[model samples]
Target: MSTGMPAYDESGDRSRRPTATNRTAAQVNTTALLDRLRTAGPQSLSALVQHTGLSTATVNRLVDRLIDEGLVLEAGRAAPTGGRPARLVGFNARARSVLALDIGSSKIAGAVTDLEARVVRRRRSAIVPGDDARPALYFFEALADLAASLVKDAATGPAPVRAVAVSVPGVVRRDTGRVEFAPSLQWYDLPLGALLEERLGLPVRVANDVNLLALAELRHGAARGRRDVLTIALGTGVGASLVLGGGLYAGSGGAAGEIGYTLLGRESLSTPWPGFGDLESRVGTAGMLARMRERTDALPDGFGPEDFLGLARSGDEAATAVLAEVVDDLSLTIGNAATLLNPELVVLGGGFGRAAADLLVPAVRRRLQGRIPLLPAITGAELEEAQLIGAAELAIDLAAAAPSPPT
Candidate 1:
């Protein structure tokens, strides 16, 4: 199992009983169905009825409730020379907003998004060196201020902020909201969720930054509509998210998808690769740079990975050799993952993954050509702020999942 962090449960239990709701199970199911429709895009009533196996009358009633709640809106008429034009329904992009915040080692990024996850406002600020604890606190305050400012600019009446989604560079347990380990930010076992919830006065959902990126992609990026997908983030640290049956497979303890720690040299090489040393040893963008430095002296003094890619592009022999090594390693790792997980789509993401696409994709494809049965389709993220965008979706999901607040 991929391991990074333990799931945090404030109640201190692995299993908890479901709450008795004011509504029936069927009602809850109908509400969830409507939420899905909003996120996935507009659907006709017949489509909903067919997909959900709900009766047409029941689906109609549910849609009526959602329309009244301002969650879903009528877009237009579906095409047909039918008796009556079908009313197109989709999420109201302006109904309310979700705040997504992504805390990276280098900077803090925030986005204000509508219920449909369309970003309206965005802000990014570099981290200031000081006590590590203070930066998270400060950035969140700034994020909250940005959110308030955005809300004020909108014309919607008392648009209640749904929830805050935070993606941190560490292993997070959303249930209890703890950071088991975050090498880039140098945080360990931090009570991030609860603290953020308390500080922001909004329910907070915390998750690994890469996982959020994967979630974003699954929902709206290259992996959309793919039930089995594997997204590899190759920048600072090599991490992955595996989607099984269209939902994130977080494993037994929220530690799944930590593919960076996958033991590499065991079968392929004679030398025993003592693998990913410590925090920062195997995680993040800097970690990869450090590994490159240890292996070759051909790189320049102030070289970044981009420079290496440039050299490879220019056919510089030494740079090509180093670049090839990374591709080979990555391809081998991906091949192994493919053999095991058998995901339908394998999306390559992160800064490095995006920059070295010319180098990464061909190599990954070549590595799996004869080795795997059906190679996963490799693709890149379409959006620049996929992780930040997904964070907002996570927050909205949490808010919607919660028992409706007291009337």
Candidate 2:
């Protein structure tokens, strides 16, 4: 269970200290320095001192220790000044690795990335339904197998991994690491974090898939550095993730963005929809398909939400009409979310979001223009794997922020 970091120095050592106050400043300084390094990359000792507002001696000592621990490295010299150019120190991204898992209703996608969020390995697996009696275990086994395979293939030189971040398609409480409910997956109160951590022998972090996507966007995509933002992932289920004050906003029960359960129109027996009273139940891919089927018996094979969008793009009249209705419905939903959250920007993401980007963005924008006096700017996610990409981010952020245990 030794994580390979120097936990303590019991024997006589020049740097070892027995008093808490002796190490308090170093700990605080390191945390502050790490944040700067993350944001601005490598810097000279003078630059670090100025950025962290720490003394030059303290910055130099911290940078030296980080370099010795392989957490940082001396890159080239800074620009030629009058004297010798100070050695530039930068974060050694390869020193730490993280595994990100994107668990979905019908498939699982995963990728291993370095501390800098560079993907080292990627894998995907189809998630066929379990015997209905043990769905949780079935999905878990698939995830474990994928993690094991990735770890085996990776170069294990680094001290294992700092953590694993799993993105689930529902409300995820960060404190408990429990997935409250993933209606698309029909999961509830599942200890997904503990299960993965125990199975893989590493720390595990979990978050709502849409929320994670928003985190990814904020970190490295369209929503970078934005304070108030909303990301709506349109997939098997419609969900929203909000970021306020530069941090993701999860409600009291971690159910802040369960937009799928919204009420939209009345239900009829002739059109029996899954989760029949819910709005997402009415407009989700399946619902749209069911309605589409009523109009045309010759529905295209494998006609899901993505296909519907493709058909719309191809100028299929039926498909266009269906997508138009979806756009209108989604526009209304977006307006409601915008009015309430008043986010700086609203990003449309996930499988449906990407495919219907051509359709959804314009419709949502137009809806906002007419409905609200003030509208948040609308945009589509740039990444193909927005959810999985965000999963990587969640893992790295948690690992960097975890507290060290006392000796």
Candidate 3:
């Protein structure tokens, strides 16, 4: 099961006789140094020492370890500051590869990416309605097959996949890496991460799709510079993810972003889906399409949410009316979230959200402007494949933190 390449240990050797508290401190400092270099670009040893507030010797030792692990690289020399020019080091973003998956309602998308989370190869497969009814063995087999194909097709030619990260439309238990609930996919308490790790022979991480979207925005998309941010995804369904004080907040049960279940009106005995809740039935893509169908029987054969938005933008009266109603419902829900969280930035993402952002943002803002005590900036996501990108980010992080192989 060895990867042929030497494993990396971001926290240095844990078997050393350093005190537990000192080891923890060193690990934290190492993470901070890597993050600093990754974000601020290359820096000289002295510069890193100054930024990290660590002693020169400590910084030098850490840098040497990182370089030996292939996570850090010497970029060049810095300008002399009255003495010898210091050599600069930077994150080696392409030194390793990660495999990421985005399991959606009707499709599963996989990609191979570098340490920078840039996709190098991608593949996808459709999921039929009855697929989930099959045994978990079959499901895992199919997933593992797809993952193997993706790895084999990596453009780098047989490079080891350092880690795997999967995104599911569900509440993922952070501690157990279990899908606690996934109404859309009918998954409950599934140990998906463990199964994947067993099959792939590598560390695996799982997260909620919406949460990953928020992470993508917070790290590399529109909400990059914001500390408190909210990402609302409107696709086949509706969900929200929160980032508070520059960190993703998954709440106690990993359900912090389950805003789609918020009640907007009286509860119904018959649900849209088996476990779908009130607000989702009203504001989700399915609801929007149903409403559009009710308004017009002459609808195009394959009309979808995107097509409806296009028609609305082109001044179709019926489409515009349908969009306005959905916008109202969404604005009300988002306004409630805004009032409670008071996020610095609200990023609208997902297929429907991104397509209808130009139309929805203005209306949502108008609805919130008068209701909330303080208004926050609202905008659309500026990144594509946000969930995939975020999954890659998680994979890179897990790979970077993994223990080094014995020499």
The best candidate in terms of TM-score: 3
Which digits, one per residue and each the tens of the lDDT, describe model 2 over residues 337-372? Answer: 777778889898877776677677887687668687
- lDDT by residue for model 3 over 153-186, one digit each (tens)? 7634734687888889988886667888876666
Q: Global lDDT of each model?
A: 0.68, 0.72, 0.77
For model 1, residues 1-407, the per-residue Cα lDDT tens digits are 11111211111111121222344544444445555576557888887776666678877887787677676788788887657977878876576667788887778787777766777776777766576557555655664565455445542544556677778877777567698887666567878777766666667778887778887787677876677888888776777787776667777777787777666654434434343423223434566566666667666678887776787799876666666667667777788888888888888888888777767788778867988887988877676877887787776655443333444
Clashing pairs in 3: none
Indicate whether candidate 1 or candidate 3 has the larger TM-score: 3
**What C-alpha lDDT does candidate 2 achieve relative to the native structure?**
0.72
Whole-structure CA lDDT of model 3: 0.77
Regions of candidate 1 where Cα sits further than 4 Å from its true position:
1-27, 39-47, 74-89, 131-160, 266-301, 399-407
Name the top lDDT candidate.
3
Candidates ranked, most accurate by TM-score first: 3, 2, 1
User: What are the RMSDs of all candidates, in order?
Assistant: 6.2, 7.0, 5.1
Q: For each of the candidates, give the backbone clash count.
A: 4, 0, 0
How high is each candidate's TM-score?
Answer: 0.80, 0.84, 0.89
Model 3 CA deviation exceeding 4 Å by range:
1-22, 129-138, 152-159, 266-274
- Model 3 poorest ten-residue lDDT run: 8-17
